[model samples]
Target: MPSLPSAASAADMNQVEYLGLCDRTAVEWETLRNYEMFSLSPDGSFPMMKASRSKAVRLADREVMMVGGGRCFRVSLSNHPTQNKLQS
Candidate 1:
């Protein structure tokens, strides 16, 4: 298959198989904050964690993984509007 065009080059170029996805500026991934940031009560409707200073909750060995909705607040890094970060 043909390769994608660079972010720099115009995507208007016609390709045989695949469009050149190169030359284009790469989109970045972003994180955001949730309601859990405000309330730390184990029942704030959202769970949170601090990877740098906070410790992760211990789980049972060989136990099934916990499945539920979770949330957190993180400082927004990029110009994105949705991304955010929880300040400790």
Candidate 2:
């Protein structure tokens, strides 16, 4: 797929097939509270999953593989208004 605009935020990167640390931008990933691990859907209609500081990988679709805190987890994207965070 073609590259998104220069100001592509995490929400705009839902269709991205790959994700890395370099893909994060302050305007997109950094929250007012903290730069926590999170994921959102393309249409901005889904709830945001705010996990801990973890190594994460986004699948080709709307799913994320997160590994941190001595465990690994998988999350499926959906349209809900809730914050699913892992408790430390």
Candidate 3:
């Protein structure tokens, strides 16, 4: 499996390939490696946001609604989260 790309290296990847890499990595870590054992919140009751100046609200369906950089998006609290449709 290809290693996760660094910020500089990731610039060479197109959006689709980058997102694909992220999906594969998540599957490897969550399903194959069982890395969730190291998670601070396994149930995802408290989701973390790394985005600067972002606001997040936990939804009823175990998804987080984030607003940052003039964009709003939802992220799933699941092992194999699906990618959101990209807006042009």
Indicate which candidate wins on lDDT. Answer: 2
- In the range 10-79, model 1's lDDT, one tens digit per residue, is 5856653211112122211122222211112323322232222223221223222232434332221233
User: Over 4 Å off in model 2, which ranges?
Assistant: 1-26, 30-39, 55-64, 67-88
Q: Score candidate 3 by TM-score against the native.
A: 0.17
Query: What lDDT tens digits, residue by residue, belong to model 3 across residues 11-77?
Result: 7767732121112112222222211211124333333333223433332334444443331112243
Clashing pairs in 2: none
- lDDT for residue 68 in candidate 1, whole number 0-100: 40
Which of 1 and 3 is ahead in lDDT?
A: 3
TM per prediction: 0.15, 0.21, 0.17
Candidate 3 wrong stretches, greater than 4 Å: 1-39, 52-88
Residue 8 of candidate 1: its Cα lDDT?
A: 57
Q: What is the lDDT of residue 79 in candidate 3?
A: 45
